[model samples]
Target: MPFAELDQPGDDRGELVGLLKRLGLRTLGDFAALAERDVAGRFPNDTIIAHRLVRGLSHRPPLRRALPPELAVTERFEYPLQRLDEAAFIAKALGERFFTGLALHSLACTRLAIHALTEAGEERVRVWRCAEPLTASATADRVRWQCEGWLARPDDRPTAGIVQLRLEPEEVIGGQSLQLQLDSIGHDVDAAQRAARACVRIQGLLGPDAVLMPVLDGGRGPGERVRLVPWGEPREATQEDQPWPGRLPTPSPALVPRQRQPVQVRDAVGDVVCCNDRGELSYPPAVVVVGDRPARRVIGWAGPWVYRDSAFAKQRHGRIQVSLEADEPNAGEVALLLNGAVGERPNWHVEGIYD
Candidate 1:
């Protein structure tokens, strides 16, 4: 809304009164009923004056004229400002004012507000929150950049141009004379602000969804266990209700899926031995050969294991046969001995490392 629009009697004043009523304050008498000092203490600045008007006091001295010794400054522009650059210039001037004021009072403003008087007379405001109060020039520069950014967007423009710019100190804290700590914090804050600004710029150039982060999900299978979400959104915590069947307490470092290999078996008499897919040696004197190297001897072996191939959708059949052994050339090593039809070479593959 424009500042000028605010001046028309029925427009702004009625709206403001309506807002006060929404806040449970109705009628001029309701505001007048409160003490002036109490009103100022509770609401501060123009808010108190606005309430006073509701109580029927039209003439009140501007609060700026009576402000205490603290770093604060305000500037009013005569001509309406249509461009962001012009507004930034005014902001810079206001910053200078604040610094000058602080210098006089021997204090600085840690937080400030850059307020705009829309051509329609309505106020549009932006705040500059700093980790600490800063020197006048630095404060002014920051305010200028902030105002420039706020006004840069076409949607931010008031129906009317902005006519006045003001910078006011909302809070103040003592600054160090040496400034070593202040400089460190300032660098960190400046870096963070710059990064935020860059992110905004990138989002503007690319659609918001163009940037994203990966989200981890709790599930037994690979495909069911991962997801993606917006970069800024918090990651979802692991679900407590769901149980993971056959999941290990400690996960394997390498989880890549590998192709299965087959192994050959022969009896002590060199007669070929055959086991059904269930991994049992058909004859008791069977010796395993891994890549043409005969086993030193047949030691204790675990099973002709059967695994369903249905878990891997891309494979033609879900049938898989495996064998486990405790004694082999690689003692204490877990070897995956596989089975295959004749004419197809048998294969042996190591699947894991156990300490």
Candidate 2:
């Protein structure tokens, strides 16, 4: 017989098997042959006990029933809540009640869970870890944050309004008096509470997606370098952790237009300037025409940085980015991205504007 049954998926005892194998013990017979004192000295006491049980020398204890947490509260809506604000309002009230209940027992919540049921019978749940025991206002902030994330995603939206909300304490600790510094701890906590409340109010007024937070991400271009995510959503740490090459050099552009704008570069006699396959310019640019506006004289121009699209080699082959400066003081410098290889008919669009 096998000394250990560890071939199953998600087997956590592979380390134990490896350790025993390293000690030249592959089967129960080999394990049983070892002296009990030797086994105890070589490995942990638990392993020695397990070996004893397998040898019929020791017996196992009876399993005990697990108990659920004591602090849990649920609220049902008379009219379902369609707006996130409405749900947040109810969640705040529920948080107050949850804390009050815990206070009666002289306890504090260290691990919190929030659950919601939509009219469509879909259930959503989230758990939050508290560094320390949380206060009532802090609990409400967490509830608001969870609700915002739920309502922000389009597919996660309820078919009807949410009909039920539940708050449960996963872990609790004995309540203790907190010694706080007035200027430091108290001020910081108060400021954070006010900010969290303000964020919820702003999200309620402007809509969830409207109140976004900037997240840094790895990309080769200016616009791709920054990702905007809904305020309550978690931002990945790996976004800014990885090294990104070919990013625009600092002083970065003030404006990066998501929608490409058509622009033309022309020479002195109004001949449209272009690039050739040899990565050479048709002529030194003399004028720049943006949309229907009159052409402004070009003072300086730089770069034709080539970027290859390895993913779509057939369609969007590559692009060349160039920065142009116009003579008119009002017309600031702008960056242009042109599609096609150096030697083909180039199609250009405005990429960014610098102040």
Candidate 3:
């Protein structure tokens, strides 16, 4: 974050934050990148706190490594859950364990992803984004509510007994940071909860499908990574959790076209660049042409990452990130996400754009 946007209390008081900015340390990452000892040498007055912050470590008791913002607490049922009311009973015990685990690490959950599995191999996953850090009672309440809601929907209820339940913390904050929503200085603390309540009310007025939330699912192609689910329904994601080859990393394109536009990548010899079944690029991309427009020079590129479904599957899907020289007719930097499909030739398409 920017120097002015540091969440620390004294950071806004204009001494340390300003000093860091003057030294060209604009972001939190910039400070964290330097060695903790270097930061201590720079700020001798606040050596302890500054050094700790420089390492991106929290103020909690020291550990082998910094506590991660999120974690998962899983429970396997010896006696599978067959009845709907039984979930409430399970929730109490599970919530206690969940809270205790978070307490041990001095962390609190802001967003929670609940995963439930049934004896018949059915899996249901839902994520709840909360405005406040959830307590043990609140966690149990949410579990009971979610299970009750799913049971009320005949189509969504599990066919077999639930054998496993997992609570994955999606977003977390410091355990010591809990404060009153309406403080002396006016702030919109209830905004998130208000918005959630509004969605629930809308679902009541209309149908469950009235509102939808987008989830970043796992897939090789940019278009396949986004999965939209009904407002309160459990997100269904099979291609999300598993570690698969050719999956693109973070800094995904901000905008993705609904349909993949035909595009062509070529080498300096004007021959089409191809990705083989094993994902080896025939040649470095020199030019990229979207439709019949003027061919743009390839300045930067990455991948031709390939995804193989299984041993029996013959198809090989691949993707490449290509940065093209922008023309006067186009906007600033032109970066395109290209996808190659299975066939005799590399049929490229504009999967998305990093404008």
lDDT of each: 0.53, 0.68, 0.76
Model 2 C-alpha lDDT per residue in residues 75-191, reported as the tens digit of each score? 898998778688679878988999899988888887788898988898987766554576888778777767766776586665677788898998788877333546664356768
Highest-TM-score candidate: 2
| Cand. 1 TM to true fold | 0.35
Candidate 2's TM-score: 0.58
- After superposing candidate 2 on the true structure, give the runs of residues whose Cα lies further than 4 Å from its correct spot: 1-37, 40-54, 57-71, 75-93, 97-135, 141-165, 169-195, 202-210, 237-251, 267-271, 275-283, 315-343
Off by over 4 Å in 1: 1-67, 182-355
lDDT of 1 by residue, 138-157 (tens): 67566656555545666654
TM-score rank order: 2, 3, 1
Superior by lDDT: candidate 1 or candidate 2: 2
Residue pair clashes in candidate 2: 276-342, 276-343, 277-343
Higher-ranked by lDDT: 2 or 3: 3
Clashes of each: 15, 3, 0
